[model samples]
Target: MRVDEYNSFANQLQRYASALSRLESLHIRLADGCRLRAYQKRLAQVTVDPRSAIDSQLVIAVTYDLREIDEVNEIVENLPATLDSETLTLLQKVASGSEHPDDELDAPGREAQYELYLGTMLRRGGIPARHGKPDLVATWHNKEFFIEAKRPASAKGFDNRLRSAVHQARALVRPGIIAVCVDQLVRPADGLMVVKDFNALAPSVDNLVRKFVVEQAHTLRKRLSTNEPVAALLLTARVPARIAATGHSSLGTSIQLHPLLAGSIEAKFASSIIPLFAGSPS
Candidate 1:
């Protein structure tokens, strides 16, 4: 995506978030509807780049501001040690503000940093994180808590790494992870539920984020070479069931993938038997 386009998307998101915050304090019937219509109107004012080059409905490009990264780094640094330490360290390294950082020179480098940051954040927040090859072992709560992180919102290109990663993650165990992908607008139709006319509804943010993660996960697994043992998940700002599958492959056996909220990863962990690592702070 072009710099100007990304800026427009970012600005619109900021406005939507702000509007929702204010709407929360008001008491009026159909208030959400009014807010959504206003948000849609404002969004229409922004220039949205065409998705011709990128087939996915999520945000086609991710625009990052060095200043914003710095601010996030400051917040992460100050988070309580009660959060995962290793995960925090990883976040600091990936999300920390840097001037013309090396990763900025290439798409792969940028994607790696984002994946690392997200992986770390999930792990730090008590969810397990791991990379697929080079002997990185996958572990889950009683073999129930499993997840995958994707760069749909940040990466360019139509590579199948997302699917590959999900397949690798599925190798861990039966009833394993619910793979996850991160992107904006899980699907365009999803926008209609959280947004009306043109505005975002105040109560939809949490649900939207959750669905984005779950659907991405689900999509990754559905394309797997073989049936996945676990379910799929898309976690983003919008929730849609588009990625959720109704049945399994030609194996005459059904493999079920689950679409869940990324935040709900914590809840899944709380109910799992997966062994927590010693260095884990959570």
Candidate 2:
């Protein structure tokens, strides 16, 4: 879907009060001072005057929180009985940790959200996935696969996060995928990304993702070479952007898959499972 189209749909579908009530129904309550509440207030201010100066960071937070709320709601609705505890625990963590003063990218809330997001995506893709020790686990083609989702706060911490995920996967003794969200790495901190036209949105985001992949290529290759259980690295990023011509705001997302060495058992497993996520969300 086009970026603006997604923004319009999401904005229409997600309302803060409704989302909060849905979470409350699930026994998850957010503190009044939580970052999400702050985002909602910022969103309200923006809605009051669309042409006013926009806070780029607030825009990113609002967009991200909306999608997260929607995804989590769907997860709870379709969740299997066995995963009830796991899902609730993660949700509770997100609710509680969100109020922390230092709850940035490295906060437990962010990590739990990432796990929930991946589990939601996997389930939506027709794979039976559950949240757990390695973050997430799923069954595809009669084989169980583990997934460790990580979102480093900064580029310098990427290696450590990757190693931690690899270790978790190795401990499980199952074929696995290391899923990393590189939004912080790709997103510009100064301001929202501006593209000349709608057509430029995707390529602008893709170029940033490609650059990140290239910079991390050696590290990823070295990890895959030694970690037999890890079949592939899945990198995903979402950047808040605006179209200069139309003055429309949206998010540009990119997802890329990097497989293990050419002729390995792990690589073969990755190939077999790739089809399951063919049309996964951006």
Candidate 3:
């Protein structure tokens, strides 16, 4: 990506973060019967950084989505206040735009967002998390788990996607790298399809979702070949993209974060932007 495009996307990512934050607040208002004016105030407090230039349309859409959120409880119950601030940084190299179709770049963009959302979730689980050489870096008890998330163009393509992601992750040759494929689970069979042992994390919605993903991590850890232990998983977290909310006043889109997983695999070697090492590399 050109320097200017990176700067622009960085800005868009920030707006997504800010909008997501405000949307969370909006949901809280509906849940508690509190006034939403607080969220509006927060929106006003955020002044767009000129350095991170994003499309004005996205800003407008997010603002509108915040104002128009119905099914407030569904969102309030499901949404988590965990968007990685690291998403706002433009650190990696982008492919040459001239070499790829415009649509081809969208996957990496979504993957970046996925990394931020997943990274934040890890942090919430008491893991020190951030973006790293693999995609996401999670620290727990002095060990690092390098996680790579793959989002195929659609949910049906998960098999191919996981295969590819595993190949990439296996190539890393790092001690703790974990590769996970992210898919969408809207049907019971979808969950079963993603997690070979999906039923273990059941009896509740959250447990079922989380356990299924975690199981994949355990599976991949057992399956892959490495001098050190690694993990591979299948994470199903997407759904058909539709407007979460709509309003004549403003237009916006919703970014939802959901289940994740990891496991092991075999493959070629690839270098990471950040080297994998034991413990926190301060």
Candidate 4:
């Protein structure tokens, strides 16, 4: 996505959020939706970048990071014995927040975050959404749609991963949202397919990113064209940095999608997800 495109997306979301807030409140059973709504009340939060840390106000709780349990235990062991319980708790929380940020996020946490992302994105398109039993359900054109999102480790088993998500969406019995964070998108024929190998801007035109994005987009268009139950599939891509550095992938709003591939996305999803509130989006 270009800078202007991302900006436009965010701006549109704010407008939708404001519109929904004006509606007569309805009873909703979605716990996740409730929390997100409360966090983004009045469309108060704004994202400068998708990859940056989320604003504190949008998160209901500050979770303790336990990714480095050994390191955390070592810190705990060295604490002074005379410290009061409250003081020790505060210290541990601080250390966990700073030193062990990735620990507590298992698959569920990641899925929950992407679920939040989708609903957040929908609201950006002026759709009202909530999360509960079926991951998420959003309102548009006076109709409710179910959205299910998944983050697999890599694209090696893309079919299997999507199949699992598809099953979940099928159970929802509504216009379903299926989203996938592109962990590893590669054909089985490749030999050394690291994440970095796929770069659209690479000197070699046949880079991995281009191939994967095109193939993935084709797969999605074909699936949607077949009268599949899913309304849309969101594929969030990431580029992991070098190994010696943190084993983290930096995601950005600047998703440099291929023109042909992104058009497939616009046709399948952007065209339908918020049609009631939007005409053809750029």
Best by lDDT: 2
Model with the higher TM-score, candidate 2 or 3: 2
In candidate 4, the residue pairs with backbone N, CA or C atoms under 3 Å apart (3 or more residues apart, or in different chains) clash, namely 1-255, 13-124, 16-126, 67-103, 154-184, 155-184, 198-209
- Candidate 3 residues 1-282, lDDT tens each? 000001122333345345445554443122222223333333333344454554554444333223212212122223335543344341121111111112242355335435544554455445666665667666655755566776554434545555555565656656444443233323243222122222311222334346544655544444444433343332333211212232112111112222122222211111221122111110
TM-score of 4: 0.43
Count of backbone collisions in candidate 2? 0
Cα lDDT, model 1, residue 228: 46
lDDT at 187, model 4: 18
* Alpha-carbon TM-score of each model against the true structure: 0.37, 0.81, 0.38, 0.43
Specify the highest-TM-score model's number: 2
Model 2 — which ten-residue stretch has the worst lDDT?
Answer: 1-10
Model 2: per-residue lDDT, tens digit, 1-282? Answer: 113224453453455556666667777777778765665565566666556667766655555554444444454544555557888898787654443222354656767877887776677667788887878877777877778899787787788898888888778775678888887777666555788988888788878889988988888776667546777878877666768897766667677777765565555544554444334332
lDDT of 2: 0.66
Ranking by lDDT: 2, 4, 3, 1
Sorted on TM-score, best first, the list reads 2, 4, 3, 1
